[model samples]
Every structure is written in structure tokens, then in C-alpha cells.
Target: MTVDRDSLTELRDLARAFAAERDWGPFHTPKNLAMALTVEAAELAEHYQWLPTGADHELDERKREGIRHELADVLLYLIQLADQSGVDLRAAALEKMELNRLKYPADQVRGDARKYTEY
Candidate 1:
């Protein structure tokens, strides 16, 4: 699926406007926002701590739904953080991947689980 930049910008604006309306910007400084993202990510991970990674094998539907919601919350916070920081996550990710490719060449690292230097 493709995301439209304008829509994302609009969404971020709406989120910021809502937060400002409630006087929440003071709580949304970079450090606080980063900590909040980490907490939400931990909440997402807590759901699957000892559970199987497959979808169809889960026993409880409610647990699965809760996990999905928590994951979404984590992603929302991440998107907000990126928006606030003026970072293009996709571009950054691709740039990092290029660096990783140079550090971990496929011929040496493919099918190996060792560190880059070991490879």
C-alpha cells in the first residue's frame, strides 16, 4: 500500500492541533515523546512475549486484537515522532540499508548469522 505525503501531513497537523488544544505540547518534547514511543512499543511486545509468532495458531481472539491495537499505537507514535522531527523515514531507512549492504556484503553475510566483521 502507498501512503500519500499530503494526507500524512494533514494527519500530523490534526494530531498536533488536538494536542495543542489540550495543552499537551509541553509533555511532547523530544525526550518525552521518545520515551512514550518506547513505552508503547514495550506494550506491543508484551502481548507476544511467550506466544507463537503465527496468526492462525493463537488461542485467544481478544489477545490478538489487543496486540494489534497496541502495535498500531506504537506505529502511530513513531509516525508522529518522525513528523515532528522533519525526518523522512523511508529515505532514512533506504540510506541506512545502503550502508548496511556495504558493511555486510551479501557474498559474506548471506545465510550467516554472525557479525559483519565475522562475516
Candidate 2:
């Protein structure tokens, strides 16, 4: 299947097919997927761990490529986790964004970094 960068559904389908092909569904329990997702996210964060503030702005091509691959790993595991848990990943993201808008209203939280409770 064609994997379009814009399509979360396609990514989720691909991840499902990949696990099915490997008979890995049994191993992809929600807990396992969540742990794996966290590991991958840490790996992604590792790329920037030692960088000075704003150093990411100067990432060389090799560093950028490494970051891209790590990001993909994090995303794939997230999609798999959402799939195994019967969540529509895209819809959840949209829903979370709406919640964020309510919690951090633009007029009140504009230019602020504090939590909603702090305001």
C-alpha cells in the first residue's frame, strides 16, 4: 500500500498488516506498546540531549536524518498502540487539541507558559 505522509489511517493500516504478517499481535498488548512507544520517544529525544539551547536550529543533514528516523519509530509505535487499543489516533489528536484550546484559551493564556490551574 502507498504510504502517504498525510494519512494516519494508512500508517495505522500498514502497522497492523506488518504485525499480522509477523504474528506479533499477541506481543502488541497495550502495555507493551506503551512501553515500546516510550522507549522510542526517548531514543528520539536522545538526538537532542546534549545540544545547546537552540542548537537544533543548526542540525546538519546527518543529524536531521537521524532525528527523522527516530521520529518515525516513535510515530509507528504510537500508531500501533492506538490501533491495538481501538482508538482512532487522528480523532483523538483533534479532540486533545480542542481540550487544549479550552484549557489554554488564547485570550487568557496568550504568551503564557503556565498551566491552566496556574492562571
Candidate 3:
């Protein structure tokens, strides 16, 4: 569903309950959760690696569905990790975007694909 803080809080509580039932919270430290996020992201990327470049829309329907599910898995784990780590993920993401905007101003990057240093 939506990925707002309220929704993330709900998802985190659910994850807490699920982990508590199996006593798995101890294994979900910030480091491990970060690692899990990376692993899951890689798995999601693997789904499209074999497809022709720029043909993402032409993939098999089932493959597209699978990719969507994997993307959700990555997002869920990210939400859970941010929750457990006390990180305001939305704010952090926004702050990064702001920094990127300064680094690559739209006027310079509107049609230029050069690296930030090239500008």
C-alpha cells in the first residue's frame, strides 16, 4: 500500500509482532537489515538483467508481476530497517534529493547527461 510514516509504523508493528513470535528481533539489527535490503534489491535487479535494453515494457507479464513483488519486498525491508534504526527515512531521502539538486541543478542537467563534475 502507501508508504507514509503511518503506514510504515503499521508495517513495523506487524513486523515486530511477527519477529517477536519467533524471537527474531535479535537478528534484525541495523546492519543486518541494511544488508538484507541490499540483497533483496539485487534479487529484484536480477529479474531484468537478461531482458533487452530499453525493452522493459515488453517483458513477460508474469515477469513484470514478479519484479513488482520483488520491489515491494525491498521496500518493505527498507521500511522495517528504518523503523528499527529510528531513522526518519522520508526525511533522509528528501535531504539526499536536496543535496543532489544542488549538485546537479536542473538548468545545467535538463538535457545534459554529463557527470556532476563535468558541469
lDDT of each: 0.78, 0.88, 0.85
Candidate 2 versus the native: TM-score? 0.89
Ranking by lDDT: 2, 3, 1
How well is each residue in 1-119 modelled by candidate 1, as lDDT tens digits? Answer: 97666655666778788788999877877677788899998887787778767465764887779788988777667767886688876677789999999999898788999888774
- TM-score order of candidates, top first: 2, 3, 1
lDDT per residue (tens digit) for residues 24-118 in model 2: 99999999999999999988887787788527676888888988998999999999889888998888999999999999989998999998999
Candidate 1 segments whose C-alpha is farther than 4 A from its true place: 1-11, 52-56
Sliding window of 10 residues with minimal summed lDDT for model 2: 49-58
Q: Which candidate leads in TM-score? A: 2
Cα RMSD (Å) per model?
3.7, 3.0, 3.6
How does model 3 fare in lDDT? Answer: 0.85
Q: Which candidate tops lDDT?
A: 2
List where candidate 2 sits over 4 angstroms from the true fold: 1-6, 54-56
TM-score of each: 0.75, 0.89, 0.82
